[model samples]
Target: MVLNYIWIGFFVIAFIIALIKVIIGGDTEIFTAIMNSTFDSSKTAFEISLGLTGVLALWLGIMKIGENSGLINALARFLSPVLCRLFPDIPKGHPVLGSIFMNMSAN
Candidate 1:
């Protein structure tokens, strides 16, 4: 919710600055530049994602293998004691403790 307001404020400020550039400073290409940048950024993002798809799939496959082989669970159990010490407020056998171990193992 706060992020939505931040994004709106960002675009509003950008529009005001671009309006001043076009109307007061006679910089007619301000809007064109902004449009070009937006399109270019999206295109670049898409290309990067496309290129990384294979790598992402490979890593996910590896994670699945670890999960199937019980390595992830083993790691979770191994780290549970340390996590318990670090997050003593969370009980040792709580679901969140397991989640914390799983999250750490994933990373």
Candidate 2:
């Protein structure tokens, strides 16, 4: 019975309830508290992303090197048997498979 409509309905119901709480219930601080929490959450996410920038760059550089050296393609070939079983639709030796292997290693 669960559908996309139900997901949106939950948000809509919560929004209405929040509005009622702020207006009729005189819970004026709720909006301020929500805004403060939202800002704090975004700030924390930004800091984490910033901290990971160096690691992300290092992985991307390694992937680029592997691509240039054809190591990724070699790995893809080595893993082809398992990859073939996991992804039956992709043809053997497909360039996409090499890219997939690169992403897998980068992750």
Candidate 3:
């Protein structure tokens, strides 16, 4: 995932460089064309990011509601029995179990 982001960064940088080159090396028409293209691309990217952020926020809010409503706690309760059997040395209701459940629920 990190590498994917690095590649996307490289692509954006290359696009900006190309736009700069077009503005510098060409006439007024080329400059306008480049500017318009860049504006459109930026707007599209902004909209997509905004939509994704809204969706993510909604999901997080839903998850928070679930947490507060004890649904997540119920899930943890259901899993705790299996977890206890798997990790026999760990005490029931240990902090580790709670932390693990919290982390899993968050993801």
Candidate 4:
């Protein structure tokens, strides 16, 4: 998948940059610094996810309400025409058109 390539690319780029720093600048601590950066980045990502948990739950509840109230279906119907215009190849009144509207409403 694309995510696999992205992870591999990040590692490759980081390794190459660290190698260059060590070879050209004679920075013996480059690897240590690189490892520290990786740890810090992961820690930051975890902290951000933790912070977002409450917001995510709130949004999920709001989405449930919208779905139960028929607001999402109304939105999908309203957007269906626009989506058809944007994706003319999908054909008007197609099942995929409804799905596209649903996806947009969800977002």
* Best-fitting candidate, scored by TM-score: 1
Segments in model 2 whose C-alpha atoms lie over 4 Å from true places: 1-15, 23-25, 84-94
Q: C-alpha displacement of 33 in model 2, angstroms?
A: 1.3
Q: Judged by lDDT, which candidate is best?
A: 2
* Candidate 1 segments exceeding 4 Å error: 87-99
Error of 2 at 56 (Å): 2.1
- Model 2: per-residue lDDT, tens digit, 41-95? 9999999999899888988897889899998899999999989998999999999
The collision pairs in model 2 are none
RMSD of each: 3.1, 4.5, 5.6, 4.0
The alpha-carbon deviation from the true structure for residue 26 of candidate 1, after best TM-score superposition, in angstroms, is: 1.1
Candidate 3 accuracy as TM-score: 0.52
| lDDT tens per residue, model 1, 18-85 | 99998999999999999999899999999999989988898879878877787766776678788878
Q: What is the lDDT of residue 46 in candidate 1?
A: 97
Order by TM-score, highest first: 1, 4, 2, 3
In model 3, what is the error at residue 70, expressed in angstroms?
A: 1.4
Q: Write the per-residue lDDT of candidate 4 for residues 1-107, one digit (tens) a residue.
A: 99999999999998999899989999989899888988999999999999899898988798788777877667766787778778878765565655566567557
Select the stronger candidate by TM-score from 1 and 3. 1
Q: Give me the displacement of residue 16 in model 1, in angstroms.
A: 1.2
- Which stretches of model 4 miss by more than 4 angstroms? 74-102
How close is every model to the real structure, measured as TM-score? 0.70, 0.59, 0.52, 0.60
TM-score of 1: 0.70
